[model samples]
Target chain A: MTPLIEANRVSRTLADPEPFTLVCDASLSVAPGEMVAIVGPSGCGKSSLLYLLGLLDRPTSGSISIDGRVTEDLGEAERTHIRLERIGYVFQFHFLLPELTALANVALPMRRLARLTGDQIAERAAALLEKVGLGDGAGKRPERMSGGERQRVAIARALANDPAILLSDEPTGNLDSANTRMVIAEFQRLAHEEGRGVVCVTHDATVAAAADRRIHMLDGRIVAGD
Target chain B: MKGLMVLLDVAAAHLLMRVRQTVVAVAGVGVGVGFFLAVSGMMIGSQNDFIKTLIDSAPHIVASDEQRSAARQPALDAFPQAAVTVRGVRPQDEVRGLKDWPALLADARAIPGAVAAPTLVGAVAVRFAGRTEAVSLNGIDPRIEGKLAKIEESLIGGRLIDLEARPDGIIVTRPMADRLGAHVGDTLVVSSSAGTLQRMRIVALVDPDARAGFYAGDIAGYGLLRTAQVLFARPNVVNQIHVRLPNPQTAERDAARLEARWGYKWVSWEERSRDILNLLVVRDVIMYAVISAILVVASFGIYTAVSNSVADKRRDIAILRAMGFTERDVQVIFLAEGLAVGLIGVLVGFGLGTLLLEALSHAPLTMGGKPLVLPLDRGLRQYAVAGGASLVAALIAAWLPARKAASVDPVEILRGAA
Candidate 1:
């Protein structure tokens, strides 16, 4: 099957004050129904590579394609449009807006996409929360929920727009072992059962072992498991 | 537009998170707008009332027996451009009065909505009950002067027409009447500058508080034109013509036209009161400048509130960007927050201002020993101006902080979190 997200020799450099290379000649592809883990030690550019693939930051010298569409030459607005319609993001800290409840947080992306009625958005958000084992916590705010519950709510939010590609940056870095296991299982089900592409940048050994494929990086370059 | 609703929701949520700051900012704008309305209403209302009183108590145009320009020297008139200058040229002695006043009066009365009256003014002294007082005496025809002046309205004791019935009757101000210890039907000897003396009965007493018809001086007296003509030793002669028009705003133009036609000096009320009118303009500029300064100070409160909000929500902004929100979306959220505060503040201000004006209207004010209520202009234009200025200030204040929020890089924040 064609890859949902592909990076061709991608590299990111920061030139302010001095030149610094973050990701260099790092190439990878995430196919539908595949769970890929990019693992490395600190400052090895695992998250940087994931950012380039997610379209959050443009690659310095390589092309990025989402489901066969070249995104490097696209304008900022077009890149943002693709991110909204075709990709979802999950962060390490949950990052749920403190003012909103879990259901509202899940409905946020859907509301921005604006493809469904308000009623439909609410119903789908509730279902996504149920799928992530947060059915009873839809009305709870992030501050009121446990770490595990918050991470699960974050997962439900990532599925809001029904995007084909999911990119998570250290999603389980702040969760306990049990929560980490739960989040890993959720990712597995999303990739295997729901047929979605899942890419996680993580240091957790358990997450790397559970993923269908592991891409390892060292010193800003992918050294093995491409 | 549907997406805008979501951004508004996010903006509202952020404001709710810091409720105290939002309320304080809104209150600042509210106070600014309220005071603006009340102060502007009072100042403008009094100005309009004073102007109306001025127009009503005085003639719109006064055509006096004087020349606009100095009479040309006969030698200069004979030589269009003479090399030799005539120094210290003496003016010709002539009687001071309109040459054909009856015909001029007829033409003046023919103008649209004009009420013209002729008067002869002279200085006189009245003696009664061992008291003698100097008075500026106005000789008027009761029938025409009634329509031109408010003499009938100002009378305290008897009717103005009584002067016409009693050919030797006169009217005196209350102050003059009291000083002379004179009463109605009392006889007093009046002497004019021409050394002519006549005995006249006191027919009416004018209220001192009534400003119309009476000169604003120590003592004023009025009598029939024939009585004054005979007393002043100038029979069948009028010295001044006073005219009131339907529209006082056109007085300047009408005065110019009348001056050109009648060959006499005509003065409009606006020209007579130019200094006072200029002072009013300066006062208005100062009032608006002070009010605008207050609003600008109030807008700083909004700036501080929104700036703090942007700082507190930087992380949330990054996460929203990662979720595909554009920089423009972030800008809209903050702008909406500022506008919401301004809109709510304007509504509260309107209520507060109306209540304040209502309370001030019944204040205990006295003028000339008579109870007076404060005049307040409750026009809609003041509200629109105050609200518009406040909203514009608020939007500008919000724009600065919103621009900062929109430019935040999500990758930096997300990586820092990791």
Candidate 2:
């Protein structure tokens, strides 16, 4: 099966005053309907590799391709377009804008993408909230919601544009065990039932174990993967 | 369009988050705009009013016996090509009045919409009830002077035709009449600079309420041209020709044309009052500069508010960027915030400024001893200018922080947050 996202020998370095590498020569690929977990200890560049794969940061010396389109040479605008249409992101903190309610947060990406009418966008945002078990909380702001509910709202927002690749960085890190299990199950359902490629950078053991495939990293390079 | 709407929505949300800061910024802009409108309106209104009064009170164009440029030296004229340096070459003794002025007067009257009058201005002394006062006397043709100036409008007693009815008739200003303890129909002894003494009857008294009458009342007296000619011992001679045109704005061009053709010193109303007009121009420059400074200071408030918002919302900005918002989108969001404040401020300013002008106009005031109301030009152009300046200032202030926000490193921010 064709991979939804692929990275070839990707490396990211910071060169202010001195050279410091974040991701070094990392190569990875995740096929459709596959759940991949990148596991590492603190300061191991797992998040950095995920950022490189998500096209949020360019590799220092390697190329990245998303769904057969080479993105390394693409400009910032083009990369943003690809990110808007083909990929979704979830962070450790839900990062939902505190000024907006749950439904508005979910509708934000669709508004930027502008692929649907206002009514359609609203309906889809409500449906996404319902899918994440937050239908009754659509009007609730991030500050008004619990950590689990906020995380669920974040998940609904990430799925707004119906992206094929879901990239998350410690999405359940701030949630309780029950909330963690709920997020893990949602990720599983997205990967197995919905045919989406799910890649997560996590320090949680249960999250890593639940993935269809686990890639282990040390320092800044991928050490072992299948 | 949908993208822009979403950006505006986010911008509005951000502004709402800090309501006090936003209101302060908007109020700053409103005050700046309000002051700009009020001050500009007063300045422009007073200028236009002063110019109108000037044009009404004086001749549109004046042609005098004097020459704008001194005549070439007789020696130089005699030997055009020779480098002749003549010392103490005295000019010929001639009368200091326009020779053959009747023909010039005819030519002046021939001009379209021109009402021409001839006058002989001289210094004199009026002795009445044993009180003597020096006065500048204007010897005028009453029939033509009435047409060329608003002399009739300035009369508080008697009539302009009274000057023509009585051979020794004179129109003295009300203040001068008071100083001399004289009234209409009173005969007073007048002595001319030429040492000629005569008895003149006061035919009229001019009101000092009029701008022209104020000066006339201070030191000037008007009489029949024939009576003045006899009193000054200079017959059939006039030194000045005043010409009133239908449109005073065309005075400068008409004065130039007449001067070129007649070879006399033709002074337009604008030329006569050039110093005052230039002062007005300088006042306008200073006024605008001060107003611009106020707006700049006001925009700083906007800059501070927006900068604080940008700083507080850096994390949200990164998340939005990560969610696929382009740098331009981020810029638009902040720019919209600044513009929204400016737009609302302008509306508030217009309302406030109108009320201010209304209040000012009703204030009891006096100008040149005449009851006056404040003149305010409430033209739409002033509103446009004030609004445009405020919006431009706001946009400029917002641009710096928007650029900073757009250049934010989302990956770094996300990493740090992680």
Candidate 3:
């Protein structure tokens, strides 16, 4: 099967007073229907690579492609469009806008895509919340919900536009072990049963163990298990 | 369209979350607009009332003979473009009357909707019962001047048509009559600068108080055209022709046409009172300038409020950016906040301004130690202008902070947190 995301020898460098590298010469791919985990020590550039693969950051050298389309030369707006329509992200902090409720948070991406009517958006957002096992918390704001519930809502928000690939940077980093297990199970279900690729950067060994494949990185390079 | 809806929703949510800051911004704009409405309304309303007084008591159009400097020396016409300057040029002492004024008057009367009257105006002294008083002597065709100046409406003792009926008849103001201790039918001798004297009967008297507070109350007397022609030593001539119009608003256009056709100095009421009109313009400029300054200061309040909001919402901005919102979307959200604040302020300001004006109108007002009636303008158009100006000021102030929000780098922010 064709890979849903492909990164070929990508290297990202920072241009501060003294130049430094974030992700150096990393090559990887994740096919549809697979859950992959990127595990690393502190400052090993695992999150940086996740950002590069999600098209949130640009590489200083080499290219990354999503669903067979190369993205290095795309303009900012075109990149944003690609991210909106094809790739979804869930950060470690759950990052749901505190002002909006769970359902509204999930509806935000669909609203930006503008292909769905108000009723359709609401219906789909409710369905996504229920699928994430947070149906009862749909109307609750992020501040009122627990950290695990907020993370679940964030996951539902990531899937709002039915993106082909879900890129998560430490999706369970702030959650307790039970909530971390719940998130891992959801990621697994998304890849194995729902036919979407899932790539998560994580430090938790158990979270990494649940993935179908694990890519370990050190000093900005993938060292093993790519 | 849905995007805009969502943007407004988010903007409203942000503002609602920081309710205190939003209220402060709105109230600031409201105060500025409210003051603008009340102060400008009073000034403009009073000005309109004063202009109405001037228009009502003065001639709509005044046409006078153009004075010439010795017919331009005849030889100077040959060198029309000569660069040589003439110094202390003096005009020949010609009789002070329009030549062939009867034909000019006829032409003036021929114009549609024009009520024309010829007047030979001359400074004169009156002698009655061994007392003398200086006054303006107006030589008028009483029948036409009656309609042109509304003199018939202000008569106190006798009718104005008596000037036409009695050849040597005169109409004096009540003050002039009292100063002379003269009664109607009392004979008075009128003498002009030309050293001519004539005895005229006081056929009528007009009440000066009929049009109180108007400068037309100056001590004056009027007589038949023939009597004034003889007294002023200028026969069959008039120095001025006054015109009345069906619609006073057309006076300027009519004066332009008449001056161009007749080579006379045609002055409309507006031109005759240009100084007063200029004063009104200056007053309006100062009023609006000060009011706009208040709005600018209020806009600074909005600027600080929005800037603080942007600073506080950096996290939400980063997340929204990651969620595929373009920079422009972030900018629009903040801009919407500013506009919403300004709109709410304008609405509240309009209400407060109207209430204030209503309160002012009910309060006792005095001017020059006399009870005065306030002419307060409660027009919607002025409020609309004030509201629009406030909105523009607020938008300008909102622009800088919104730009800062849009230029935020999401990766840098998220990386710092990570």
Candidate 4:
């Protein structure tokens, strides 16, 4: 099976007077329909690696390929376009626009990608929201929604373009245990049933345990993988 | 640009959020524009009327002698050896001796820079048509008067006085014309300022000021200088010879030179209507001060409104930055709000100002000697200036706020908001 993303000898260094390396000598491949979770302690560069993998950040020294396109060599606009069309981000804070409703938030990725008609985009957004258990709350703004619901909406928003890969940074960090389990279960279903690869960075052992494979990061270096 | 479009949307939202403050700020500017139009219109109208009156009555500068005792004038100032004669002149006559009336006229006509200065004399009746009023009579040379004043232009319902033909004809103002129930060719008798009575026929009626106090159908402008002198028993000598200046204001230097050359006195129109012209200038100052006060208040309103919006929208701007909206976008959003306010203000101001001016024009308001007439076309420049000032004020007021929005920290805003 073709790998949707590959990172070769990637290293990201934080430039400052102290100059600590966020990710040092790391390499990884994410295959189609794979569910991978990165487990880490505080300051372990798990989120930074996720950012680099999602093309939202560039590695200091490495080659990153997304579906065979070299992201490191791409211009800023082209990198952003790749992020818009093929990479969906789910952050712990959701970052949904307060002025927009759940439906608009979920439709955002499609809106930027320009690959779907308005009606098709709306239909897909509705189905995604339905899959995330927000069947009738499309018109509600993020501020009006519960934290769990907003995170769910963010998850739905991430799948907006039906990208081959999903990247999440602390996706279940702000949710209650029940909501976290449900969200983890949804990610499992998306990987297994929908056949889309997803990479998640998490501090919670339960979320890491739920993934089909796990990688533990310590001090900006990957220590073990399962 | 799409970014600009989004910026406008943001601006529109901003305007909607603080509707009352925005409306008040806009209204303040609108009033300023309106006030500009109204006041400037009145001033410009008055100015235009005054200038037109002066122009229509050409030879804007008229040099006239004040002495009225002499029976005749030298026909040619340049002709040092012209013959002069008079019927009742003594050998020791203090008056200059003259002979050959026809030859004197011919010699006078031939002088450089000196056109014909035909002369006239007549008296206004103290009482006419049962209405008693002290009125001064004037003697005039038709051809010479036409060059110096709008003698023919002001004649409303009658022909101008024909000095060549009737020679006994006179013109009157519309009010005086109406008072006597007189028209062209109507006979009217007038007594001089010195108690000399003479009868003359009305040939024309004219009004120098149309707003009030006079009419085109009423002051008597007599036809011929000869007939006037003959009727009033004054021969040859004339009070006030209207000399045309080549260049109007520059003539002051030349006038001083002429005064030195001929020992004659002079007065500029500014000197003639010193009080009113001074008043006009003071009124202009007061107008600027008043409009400035409104602008200062509006400027404060703009400052408060834009600053307040900046504070409220800081997070939104930061989020935009985080989402890759450039600093330029942030600046444009706030500035666009200010501009939108100014545009709406200008539109409202024009409506309000034009309405007020039209109302005043139609209303019966009189000032000093003229009725109010708003000249909108003349007021347009002032309107634009005031509107531009308001726009600049809004933009300047928005400056600090826009800078704040541009420099907002995305992480801090999210942290604080969360």
Candidate 5:
């Protein structure tokens, strides 16, 4: 299968007291429906690699290609547009806006990414919630919901644009073992049944073992999966 | 859809949320508009009253032949060739440095501009009874005084006596009438500073100050030009010549040209009322200074309210920015809020100011139980001008804070805690 995402010798450096290279040289490629896991110890540039893959941060060198489009030379607006139209991200913490109800939060990305009418947004929001098993909790605000429910809403929001690849940075980091097992099972179903690639970073052996492939990072280089 | 929802939520928060700020801003504008309304109303009322009174009593102009000396006196430089040497008044003083009466009078009358030309003269008496009081006695031609001073309606009991044919009768003002203790057919004794006891019958009492005429016992006056001339002991002197112009507005302009040709200086009523206008101007200036401070302070209230809104909504503004709302959108929202405040405040002020004026109009300002009336029209205009100014001012006051709110950085909102 043709790779949906490809990174060629990407590195990120920051200038603090001295110039420090966060990621020296990293290269990776993944195809559609291929669930990959990248696991590393803390301070090993795990989050930096995710930011680079998500297009939230730019690499100091090398280029990223998504759906065959080279992105390193693109302007700020073009990059942001591409990120908005194609990418979905689930962070360690559910960064759902507290002001809106669970349904409103799920509806936000669809509303922002498209100019759908109010009824259309409502229908889509309801369908997305029902898929995430939160049909009854859609009306509850994020503060009133449990950590698992809010994370479920965040997952619904991330799947908003039906992107081919879902990038998650420790999705079950704040959930209990039961919620983690539920979220892990959902990711597995999304990859195998829904035909979408899921790349998750997790320290849980069982969580990482659930992925179709496990890529281990010692410092900044992937050592397990080529 | 998300942006709009966010915006609506923000706007609602502003509507129901910032209670203190909105009220203060609205009240500020309201007070400013109110003051403007009240002051403007009074000014318009007072000016209208003063102008109307002047229009009713005073002739539009006075175009008399200027003489070199006293009444009926020949010009200082007279025509030696004329028989009997009884030369009428001339209007210019330029010829031989002495103004002639008959020539100037004829020149002014021939201007095609002068509609009514009546000669007028008045005298002051220092002592009338055992007590001394200042009094003015006007000498006027009844045939033409009708157009000059409009004294016919001002007369109390008897008719105004004609000066062309002096009939030993005179008219006095109401206050003069009351002070003199004289009435119609009563003999008024007037002892001049010259020690001349000129006892004349009070034929008429003219009260231009009040619509109703009043009487005085010792005051005396007369109209017969010959009698006035004999009483004052001046052969050809008339103190002033009054004229009625076809148009009162162009009267001053015409009077200017008339003075140039006739060469005797004359003053327009407005010019003559310089002392009064100066007093009015000073009062108006002081009033504006005092009231404008009130308006400016109210605008300060607007300033505080808008800034306070800005401070409270900084995080909201940041959220809007993150949602892709441009800086201009943020600015426009705040400005719209300010405009709302201004509209409400101005409306409230306009209503209140008008109410106060209406109240003042009907409610007599009694001093010692005597009513002091205020004219209605002038008061209304004054209020309108003052109120309008304040509304405009309030909007101006709100502008800066709105701009500041628009420029707030979204990154700061994320980094900074409320």
Candidate 6:
């Protein structure tokens, strides 16, 4: 089967007064049901490479493909639609909208896609929250929840659309070790048990140890584990 | 529909987070709309009031014989295609009267929607007690004049029927009666410019001060048609024909048709008050300009609020975009916030305006020594205009900030925070 996500010789460079290269000639791919962790020092372009693969940022001179469909030339609207339907992203911080309840935050992506009715959306959001260990925090706002609970709610929100590939950028940077452990376990189950492709950028050894494979980056290039 | 609901929900959540700022923006627009309504209502209402006074107090149309230098000569009448100039054209100094006025009056009465009457109007000097005053005397058939002008309604002491009972009878304005120290049964001598004198008994007195007050130059007295004709030394002739149409708005058109058919000078009330009517139009333009300025100033407040909202919610915008919301959706959410504020303000403003108008309408007023009421035009058109204008102002003010919010780059913001 084709890789769930493929980036062929991708490079992202910043156009600025003092120019800088974020990712250079980095080609990588992840097959279905694989959990891959990108490990690197700070300013080693790990998050930058992940952003390009997740279709959140444009590469300067290379292309990306998700589920064997190339996405380099798609318009902003098409890219957004693909992001809504094909990919999910979790950030370092929970980043849940402070005004919405935990359930509503999980349902935001589903509502934007509008493929489900209001009741179906709500029901699916509730199930997702329960799956992430946030069943009791459904009606509570993010401000009222603990940091670990909020991060779990964010994970539930990312999975609301049942995307094929899950991407994370420093997913546990703001969490305690206990919360980080819970998040790492969730990523493992999402890839191994649910048979979804998972890619996470992390500095923690425990998170990298749980992954099926690890890619190391240095100076904007994939140094190993191609 | 479902997509719109989500947008609205997001907009409501955002606004609810900034309750105090939202209230301030809403109140700003509300005050703007209220002031607009009050000022515009008063201006339009007073315009209507003045127009009503003009239409009610005078004949809707007056058709009179044109003043000309001389009758056409045989040469001027018979010569075909001739531009003949006659030297030394002299005006005939004769008493101005319409020839065959009774037949013309009958023809005028035949017109539809017109109340027609022949009036022999002349200037007379009245001597009573020790005072002599120059007064305008209107000679009319009491029955026809009563229908055209509400002569009976102005009667203070005696009825208009008294003039019919006594042919040597007159009705004088109360100010004139007071100046002459005359009563209902007193006799006064009235002499025309031609030195023709008649002693007429005052049968009634009308107080013009009751409604539209009489001006100092408006000394008015009335008599029977025959009495005026004898006093002016003219028989079977009237100088003026007055017609009151069913609708004063259509008087100008009817007067134009009458002048075309009768070969006379016809003047409608609209033409008579053109100068004041033009001033009213100018007043309206100035009123709208001032009101719009106030609204623009009020919109600035909304602008600041929306701008700050965009700044405060930049992170949220980036998050929404990452969640797959289109830029258009983000823009619409902010625009909806502005529209909600405007709609709420308009509703509150209209209520306040209604109360203000009610207060104004009941307040006592006077103009020209007569009691008057403030004309408050409570029409729906003005309210709609005010509401629509305020909504537009709010939308315009919100547009820039909404665009700013939509253009926020998720990568730039997300990477910065990370």
Q: Which candidate leads in DockQ?
A: 2
Please identify which of the two predictions, 4 or 5, would achieve the higher TM-score against the true structure: 5
Stretches of candidate 2 exceeding 4 Å from the true structure: B72-95, B99-114, B143-148, B193-196, B210-217, B233-236, B365-372
- Model 3, position B29, has a per-residue lDDT of 89
Residue B357 lDDT (model 4): 78
Using TM-score as the measure, name the better of candidate 1 and candidate 6: 6
Score candidate 6 by DockQ. 0.65
lDDT by residue for model 1 (B321-340), tens:
98889999999999989988
Per-residue lDDT for B279 in model 1? 95
Model 3, DockQ value? Answer: 0.69
Candidate 3's residue-wise lDDT over A1-226, tens digit each?
6789999999999999789999999999999999999998989999899889988899999999888889999999988888888888999988888889999999999998899999999999999999989989999999999999999999999999999899998888899989998999999999999989999999889889999999999999999984
Pairing residues by index, what is the TM-score of model 5? 0.64
Better of 3 and 4 by lDDT: 3
Clashing pairs in 6: none
Worst 10 residues of 3 chain A by lDDT: A78-87
The candidate scoring highest on lDDT is 2
Assess every candidate by TM-score.
0.89, 0.92, 0.89, 0.62, 0.64, 0.91
Model 5: per-residue Cα lDDT over A1-226, one tens digit each: 6676788998988886798776768888767877888888865766677677766668999878877788899875566556555667676667676667888777765665566787888888889889988999989988898999989988887876677778887888899998898889888888888878778877778888888888777677766673
After superposition on all CA atoms, what RMSD does each candidate show versus the true structure? 3.5, 2.9, 3.5, 10.2, 8.9, 3.1
Supply the TM-score of chain A against the true chain A for every candidate structure: 0.98, 0.98, 0.98, 0.96, 0.95, 0.98
For model 3 the local lDDT of residue A83 reads 86
How many residue pairs in model 6 have overlapping backbones? 0
Worst 10 residues of 6 chain B by lDDT: B209-218
Q: Which should have the higher lDDT, number 2 or number 4? A: 2
Poorest lDDT segment (10 consecutive residues) of candidate 4 chain A:
A107-116
Candidate 1: C-alpha RMSD to true structure equals 3.5
TM-score of the B chain in each candidate versus the native B chain? 0.88, 0.89, 0.82, 0.63, 0.74, 0.89
Model 1 per-residue lDDT at A213: 97
Docking class of 5: incorrect
Q: What digit string (tens of lDDT, one per residue) describes model 6 on residues A60-113?
A: 988899999899889989988888888898998778888899999999999888
Clashing pairs in 3: none
DockQ of each: 0.74, 0.80, 0.69, 0.08, 0.13, 0.65
Off by over 4 Å in 4: A1-29, A46-76, A107-127, A162-165, A193-197, A218-225, B1-336, B351-366, B369-418
